[model samples]
Target: MGAWSRLKGAFTRDAQISSPEDLLAQSRERRSGKVPVTNDSALRNSAVWACLRLRADLMSDFPIDVYRKVSGIQVEVPKPPVLISPGGSEVGMKEWMYSTEFDLDRGGNCFGIITERSGVIGPDGRGLPGRIDLVELGSVSVRGKGSTITKYVIGGKEYEPWDVWHEKQYTVAGFPMGLSPVAYAAWTIEETISAQQFARDWFAGGAVPLAELKNNAKTIDREAARVARENFRAAVDSSGLFVHGVDWEYKPIQAVASQSAFLEARQYGATEIARFFGVPGDLIDVAMSGSSITYASIGQRNLQFLIMNLGPAVGRREEAFSRKLVSGPRFVKLNTDAMLRMDPEARARTIGARITNRTLTPDEARALDNLPPLTDEQYGQFDRLFGPRSAPTPPTTAVPGASS
Candidate 1:
């Protein structure tokens, strides 16, 4: 026989002690002086105690499947004939559909049995401090899914089909799976069986009733939580708020920005930009609420305008241009010193001249030194403010009514 089978057989056999407590007391006595109790002892003690507590609750037999059929009856009738008027011909109609549905619910029950064995001899040169053996008999239920179908018919007509969806159920009987009841019984009978071995090593090494073991498991769980938090924080810090698994660089940002820039230009009453971008004025109105600029909305003509009129060309490739705008040498120093230095009226005059394609006055030129700080927010706003004028005018550049 295999070691497990032999251990099981030994446990099933009758023992000298009559009660479970007596068996425990005997096992402790046998090991009292021979082997010092260690952490392993505590675990074993806990398991044995747990088994003792559950011994009375162990199930002797578990339920099994007893398949049975459930019958369903369906009935239908036709309404009496009705006429809209006395002269109208009678009209008849019959019930068109009738059917039933069936399904099964199945479940199983299981139990566990534990036993121990031990032996010791006196100091008479004979065998002493004999081995302790632990054994367990697990009762498990196995079930499988099943199905049934039935159909019925009425005179010269077809009816709906019915089906019974079968589910599996199981219960332990005598032993789990194919094991005999004797083997199941043996798990509760052995003397040297360690409760710890039966409950922990023999099973899943569960850490029940042990604080340290539970804490260790918790520590691992906490570390996992920490790592997840760090990863999420890093992601948010780099890219701002976003939906999970969405590629930030390619998706919603560009889409939203394009939509916003178009809407804002229209809000500023820039019909040319709206039409050039192929977006309606109302859509531009909504997009303007949030500050953003879409490169797609800014055509090549608009980029060219900014490069030629506002800044020096840094670089250019086919269909793409990069420009850099610099303030006067002393403008940065002036901004650092004061905020209310520039008069709005004078600034407006300067902006008007620039808008009207005229040269700046001496006063306006010096006032440019007080230009406001250029932040991303301000830049985005300026794009909406001035972007429309820079947008390409299709009619001006087009040969009227020319076909491609």
Candidate 2:
């Protein structure tokens, strides 16, 4: 059975696996009705591709770091080889993150096989997976029992839960597998695709341009009419100009009303698809009408997107990584400071305010700009130019008597 069919069955408590014959029948039924859509085919839709690309790109750019809680305080630790090279040296962390995140966003589930292990043991008494090779979502199958997945089948081979890595989102109370946003938004995507195809076909030999031409000088026969039509089309196509005598009358055609509506429908479809993927329409260049919310800077826009849309997915991934990839008090965090960085002017102003308020030290602020601490010579130069920094007065008795 295709994963799409299995995904649909997951919503029900009594869902059962269908035999190959039954699956074939279902496939035929779908073929007889509406066209069946697959993940690869769905990408042909511009809006769907844009939404998935935006989500995957943003998630992959953020660095994933490991931290350990020591004495009730969290301290960053070096990431293990599993995180640095999750799919082995062939695939680095950035590419692995992008592939897995792309799958999770599009299919609602990502699966991988544990290929190698490290010497360090985890809580489960086995060494953590040193390398995990991500599997294609279409090639994997899961058997679940009321919110718990029992077995994973990949390439006709069954594996235990510990031997596999699975991450899911858009979860439900009873279903073990996550629900796919692409499946839910299939209708909208298909409609937009159809409209786009129609437009392409219409312009490419589907319909002739509606127009009429007549010669006031004389009446032409069938052969002459064909010659004149071919000559006019050739002239128009070659130079975009058809010169003729005053005896010839030409009237151009106007598009039908229904054809114009398809443009608006496609735009609306893009907005709806962006919403399904939890991406802002503006980020993907989808036009929005009557939008009141505006950002003072790019940082504000990114902050809003992080908080309202991408934050939950990041939290879920953190929990999954912390639970499965490491032992003891170590946890995973996807650093979002890069995504939330402000423009240069706004960043300077904010850092300056923090330094003035004593909430941030000058060196720390400099570190934010990736600069090293100032040396004694540089400090002396600043002192000479801007005068010495202020300091608190020291208490003294003998010094006070001398002054008196």
Candidate 3:
């Protein structure tokens, strides 16, 4: 093989596309210095907001379940210290969920620093993590075995990875380093932001018909030009009048926002950026998507979203939590029932079918509906409806009228 071919092969095989260095090289070589979405200004984009909203919904709506193994059976971890007020005093599950989601989605990593020693013990004599502080993604850096993160360098202090619970997206480097979404799609996001800004500025940045106030008599002074500018703005903006100076003729300087295709380009960019972040472009581009095509139902749409986008991502999170938080049969489960909640009638039918198939129990189905457990009377009624007496009643030997 040629030397050049060998080098090309190496680059293709070893290219860490997720790394900022390679991403920057590509953007700079082709795009005009793409700006990272980490900026405060970049977060204002509608597409960015949509991505954030989706991540937040996934994290917060799907509740966390902590379970422990006792003997040979698995049950809920009795008063799991981590779940009970994870985000320190006063903050609870909701706060923990959002912040963690924010970090994992944007920075590709979420950390929970075990703090606040409660100085108390559980029945098993396991001293609980009193409080959990979420470390800022930008503040921590990894240092350890193949990115196993032996230490988290935060605020000039080093912390053991064990002390700071971490959940990170898988990477080629085998380190816990998560690729930043903003960085990965920087070029697309930057272009979108630029186009939107251009449109805004074109309309609001003193856009007006320029009339060459050619004072052939003498050069116009600064004060005179300033007065003329103010007058021109007031005349054009306030009223559709053309106030001008002496010996000045109108010059057509029409606003060319449409001609520039600023909004169109911005919409395209927004859609592309949304796709880059695994959000459906149509969610942020209603006008572009058009109304002819429609989802059969919201449930189907959500199911598609889960299957095509979030399924693998959720699985990665499950593995991360299971590997880091617990040792044995104890594991974490993200209850996606919230996302699976269908239309009332649809849900009822589906649950009933599942019960018929014996895959889901009546109690389990009721739990999905957020209803309390059935009372004895309700249970008896259910038994009568579909339980032990599912078979036909024994044929009576004695006739109804003439009893034995």
Question: By TM-score, is 1 or 2 better?
Answer: 2
lDDT of 2 by residue, 368-394 (tens): 778998889999999999999889566
User: What local distance difference test score does each model get?
Assistant: 0.27, 0.79, 0.65
TM-score of each: 0.11, 0.79, 0.70
Give the per-residue lDDT of model 3 (tens digit) for 240-359. 787556766556565565646776787778877777678776655533646454788898888888888777887787776565444456788887767877898887788899988779
Report the lDDT tens digits of candidate 1 across residue range 144-207: 1112112211222222221111111121232222222112222222222333233343234242
Better of 1 and 2 by lDDT: 2
The positional error of residue 96 in candidate 3, measured at the CA in angstroms, is: 0.8
Model 3 regions more than 4 Å off: 1-39, 68-79, 116-130, 142-150, 206-248, 256-260, 285-287, 290-293, 358-404
TM-score: which is higher, 1 or 3? Answer: 3
**Clashes, model 2:** 0
